[model samples]
Target: MIRMIIPLAIFLGLVALLLVSLETAEQRKLVASPLIGRPVPNFTLPGLHDPDVQRSSADLQGEPYIINVWGSWCWACREEHPYIERLGNESGIPLVGFNWKDERQDALRWLNQFGDAWTFHMVDFEGRAAIDLGVYGAPETFLVDHEGIIRHKHIGPVDQTVFEDLMRRIMEMRSEAES
Candidate 1:
């Protein structure tokens, strides 16, 4: 009876430790990306609106922009769509969308339904660009500076708080660049 109780207690302790670790990881707002502080990956994907038109990292170099990875199948993208639209409208910032592994028609329909917030949507049907950016899933965003360096990355949906934080960072970066 004593041996059985000890073994049960050990098992419970291990389970508790695992749960704690997982909870701590989940609480983190951003997952560190290897590409941070590096140049944006070089890849030209077709435009979501017009497949014949393409945009590459070179096109995004003139100004600071946010590259938001999303898909029609991503529920979190839907949840965050309004805030993204607001960010684009209110801030007048260039917001680019990387449509990851999604059907072009579905992506267009989704954007049409939710309201298009992106200045230009890059269609990444094969997810090759996403892979280069170290994307784990949809709804991840990368804040690229004017020189095309990836300054920060947000792993989840961008909410009001996240948007504010990003704005603050961008302002700081701009100020630093000017000075």
Candidate 2:
């Protein structure tokens, strides 16, 4: 009888874990980034449009900005590009496009076809910089404050809801600084 009860208890515990996971599915999608409140990883990568030109983390100091990690091959990146364009056109914040593990020509073509919204673009062909940034996949975004510290990170495509959230965070940051 005791042996039978042990197996029954294990099955019930597994069911409970599954129930909790199912209940928090949406929350799980927003996987927290460890880089929050830390400095942006140092990297100097070539510009997507012009490989001879290089952009570095050091150059982005003294202003709040967004660093969007994307690849031409990522469908989610395509989904989020419109919102990113909106931010670049309206937010008054510089948007840095970090192209990871992609072919340079393909990246340029994608921007040309999709409408370039980034203030500038950097290419990480080998994905070395991405490792430092703790990248899990494409379409990740980082919000960096004026002091070059990463304030927030979103792990997936920035849909309309996520866009609003990002805008709200930017506004809050600005207001906090002004006071």
Candidate 3:
């Protein structure tokens, strides 16, 4: 009937308008990235190696440091563990670890089996705290400065080349700041 067609046509038109609007209009979203010079989200979470203790973001103060978020559940983390060890052992900057959402026993076991490359590793169980820090996955590293500000972020496995570049940049930045 004519009446039925009018309502159907109106519904179709509204649907089409919605589709077109969505195509043309960008959705508002908070994009998290570390290009440079942004204050890192501060946190104090339980330590994996020490449950009764907490690792304070404030402790990262007074020195430029490398903070890596990782877990035994992540494959890339397994691949990158040795390199992380290298960085922790050799890098001029202080190295810290955030052992993300993982089994407590497994985390402790992993560090025991492989090595505790971190100065002190924070145990982030359930990943709620890591989510607040904008963590998408394991093996992500944030380079922070003496002021506890995030200077840079690396999203994947970092090799010597990447490490070299970032360290070079941080050194340059530090030199500039001190002068």
lDDT of 1 at 20: 90
lDDT of 3 by residue, 117-144 (tens): 7888888787777876778877888888
Better of 2 and 3 by lDDT: 2
- Candidate 2: list runs displaced more than 4 Å: 1-14, 177-179
lDDT of 1 by residue, 56-122 (tens): 8887786788888999999999988888887677655588888999998899889889999788889
Per-candidate total of colliding backbone pairs: 0, 0, 1
Candidate number that wins on TM-score, 1 or 2: 2
Which residue pairs in candidate 2 have backbone atoms (N, alpha carbon, C) closer than 3 angstroms, thus clashing? none
Clashing pairs in 3: 48-123
Give the CA lDDT, 0 to 100, for residue 81 in model 1.
89
CA error at residue 177 for candidate 3, angstroms: 6.7
* lDDT tens readout by residue for model 2, 60-170: 988788999999999999998899999888778899999999998898889889999899988999989999998988899888888889999988899999999999998
Candidate 1, poorest ten consecutive residues by summed lDDT = 170-179
Order of models, best lDDT first: 2, 1, 3
lDDT of each: 0.86, 0.90, 0.78
Give lDDT for model 3.
Answer: 0.78
Candidate 3 or 2, higher TM-score: 2
